[model samples]
Target: MVRIVPFAVEQWMDEYETWAKYNIAETCSASISIDDLRSLSDDPSRDPLSTSTKLTYGAIRGSQTLRSHIARLYAPPTGDDSSTTVSAENVLITPGAIQANFLLLYTLIQPGDHVVCHYPTYQQLYSVPESLGADVSLWKTSGEDGWKLDLEELKAMVRPSTKMIIVNNPQNPTGAFISQEVLAGIIDIARQSSIYVLCDEVYRPLFHSLDKTEWPPSLLSLGYDRSIVTGSMSKVFSLAGIRLGWIASLHRSIIEDCAAARDYTTISVSQVDDRIATFALDPLHAGKLLDRNLQLAKRNLGILKGFIDAHRDTCDWVVPRAGTTAFIRFSRDGRPVDDVALCQMLQDSKGVMLVPGRRCFGEEFKGYVRIGYVAETEVLETGLRELGEFLKAEYASVPLI
Candidate 1:
C-alpha cells in the first residue's frame, strides 16, 4: 500500500466549505452558471451543448476545438498572428488541472527520482510526488520576502539526479506571482541540468494587481522544450462547473507519456463538459469572461485589503499581486495566534470560512490563514465584516502560540 500524506487543504475544504454561510475560503473567481456564460458571449443563441450529437466517450484526448483554444494560450507576443508554436497536439485535456498534475507526475516520477518543488503551494504538487516514492526537496520561500523563490537556492538544490522542478505560478495561498525574470532564470537553470520544469498555472491570466507589461509568459512559451504547464477553466474563467483543464507542453514525449498514464485513470472527460469548455474558451467569449473575473478579483482584493488594513495591529500580509487567495498572519501582542483554532472559531461562530496555513500549507506557516477573497462581492463583504466582529468579540479567546 502506498502511504500518502493526507491532503490537508482539500480535507479542510471538504469538511467546512459546504456548510459555511460566508464561503470566503473558495479559491475560484465566483463560479458562473451556463446562463451567465451565454450572457458574456456575442451570440446567446449558440448553445454550448450539442443535444443531437452522439456522446460515445467523445474525443479520447479532448475535442479539437477545446485543445486548439488551450494551445492558443501559449502563443508568444511576437509570434505569428494566425498560429501558435504550441499546437493542439501539444495539449491533452483532463478532468481538471489536478488530474493533469497527477497524470504528469505518475508518468514522469519514479522511485528514487529527485524533485525540487516550490513551497507554500498546493499540497498535491509536492505530496503527490513524494507518494510516488520520489525523494523530494522543498525549495522554500519566505512570506517576509513576498513569497519569492530565490534562484540561487534553486540552483543549489539542483542535483545531477534531479528529475524535475515544480512550481505554482500566481501561487495558491499566498497569491504571489513568479515574475518573468525569475521564470527565465528557472528555465536557464533547468536547461543546464536537463531537468524538466512543471509549472502549475491554474490561476493564470487573472493578474488583478499587476500591469500587463509585468505579466509573465506561460512556461510553454519560455523556449524550453521540457517546460510543462497545467491550467483549468475553474479559476480565471469562472467555469468550475465544466471541470475542464489541459496540459500543454513543447515536449512531445511528456505529453505522450501523460496520455498513456491517463488511459487507466480517465478515458475521456464528459462530452457535455468538453462542449461547454470549448464555448467558454472561444475567442469571441474568452476575453469577456476573463475581463469579468479580473474586475471582480480587483474589486474584491481592494475590499480584502481594506479589511487587512483596518486590522493592521492584528493582521499582516504581503499583498497578493495576482490570483484569488491571500495569506494573512494573525498575531496577538507580537506573538502568533493559533491559526487552526482561529479558523475553526470563525467558521463555527461567525460562519466565515478560512483555510489555516499552518494546518494546510506547512507547519512553518504558523499564525497564517489563506483567504480566497475573489468571491462574490457581497459574500466577501459580509464575511470580512463578520470576521472583523469576530476579532473584536472573540480574538482574545483565541490562544497565542
Candidate 2:
C-alpha cells in the first residue's frame, strides 16, 4: 500500500505551532526576519544585493557565489573542498536539510540494502530508508550516559551487507553530538565495511562554549572520502524561513546523483533565497549571526535549567552540549508519565507547545519530551513558569518512583 505516515513530530508542530502563546516547540533559534538577512547583506565588502533576481525557475546548478560561500564553511582536511577548502563542484543545493537527506536516501540506497542509523534521529533518517526496503538497525543513545551514541553497537550492527551508516550530530531533540573521537571511530567502521556514512551536520557551531565540547568541523571535512554531509541554514543559523540547504561530499558521484534526483523534485532553490543565504554566509556576517543566535539559545537554556532544577524530584535531563533543544524525562514517582497526554494538555490549556519523546525517540521514550530553548527570553521564562505550575498542581504529590 506504500503508506508513508505523516512525520509525527512535524505534524504535531504544524497543528499547534501557530496556536501556542509561548511557542517553545520551535527548533530554530526564534526566527530570522528579512531584516536579519538585510543586516548581514548590508556589509560593504560584498557586492550589494541584486533586487533583480529573476523569478524564473532559477539555476539547477545553484549560484556559484552561494556554493562558494557554503564551500568555505567546510574548509578542507576535515571538509571535502579539495581545491581550496571546497569547490562549487562539491556542493548541491536543496530546499532544506530535510530535502537534502531525502535526495541522499533516494539516490543511494537500493532495496534490501542494510542501513544503520543513530536512533532518536530526525524521523526521515530511518523512515526514508525503511520505505525504500532497506534493512535498518538502530544505534541507540544512552540518555543516562549523557545521550552519547553507542559506538559498540555500531561495531556489532554492521555486517558484510551493510551499505550505509547514518548519523545526526548535535542531534535533534536530544542535542547530543559526536565528538571528533566519536567521529573518527564511526568513520573507521564505515571504511572497514566499505560503506558510506551520511552525517546530518546541520547543527554545526551550536556547541556550548562554556562546556568542554568545542565547535567541530563537518564530517565532510573529517577526511573520509565517502562521508556525505547534509547541512542547512535552518538550525544554528536561525534561518528556517530561507529553506536553503546543501550536501557536501568528497565523492563526486554522490553530488551528481543528488543533483540529478533534485531535478525530479524541487528542481532548484529560489533565486531570492540563494541570494539571501549567500549574504548570510558571507564571512564578515556569518560569525556575528551565529553569535547572536548562540547568545539567545544560551539565555533560554539557563531558564530551562532552572525549571528542571526546581522539578528535580520529578524530572531530569542530560544537558545538551550543543544545539537548541534537549530531551528531558519527567516522571511521577519513578513511573513514566504519559508524555503525549501531558504535552497535549499543556498545549490545549496553557498554550505551551513541546514535542513528546514518542515523536522523536519512539514509544520506548514516551516518558520524555523535547524542550527547545530558543524562543525570546521572556517567552521562555513564562512558559517554564506555566509548566511548573501545571506540574505542581498535577504531579507534585506523586512519590519519586
- The reply for model 2, stretches above 4 Å from the true place, is 41-49, 76-84, 209-213, 396-401
User: After best superposition, candidate 2 residue 2: deviation in angstroms?
Assistant: 4.0
**Model 1 Cα RMSD, Å?**
1.4
Write one digit per residue (lDDT tens) for candidate 1, span 65-182.
Answer: 8999988878777743532399999999999998999889989999899999999899999999999999999999998887989999998998988999999998998999999899
In candidate 1, where is summed lDDT lowest over 10 consecutive residues? 75-84
Question: Cα miss at 382, model 1 (Å)?
Answer: 0.3
| lDDT of model 1, residue 222 | 75
Clashes of 2: 9
RMSD after CA superposition, every candidate: 1.4, 2.8
Query: What are the lDDT figures for the candidates, one per model?
Result: 0.92, 0.82
User: Residue 344 CA error for candidate 2 (Å)?
Assistant: 0.8
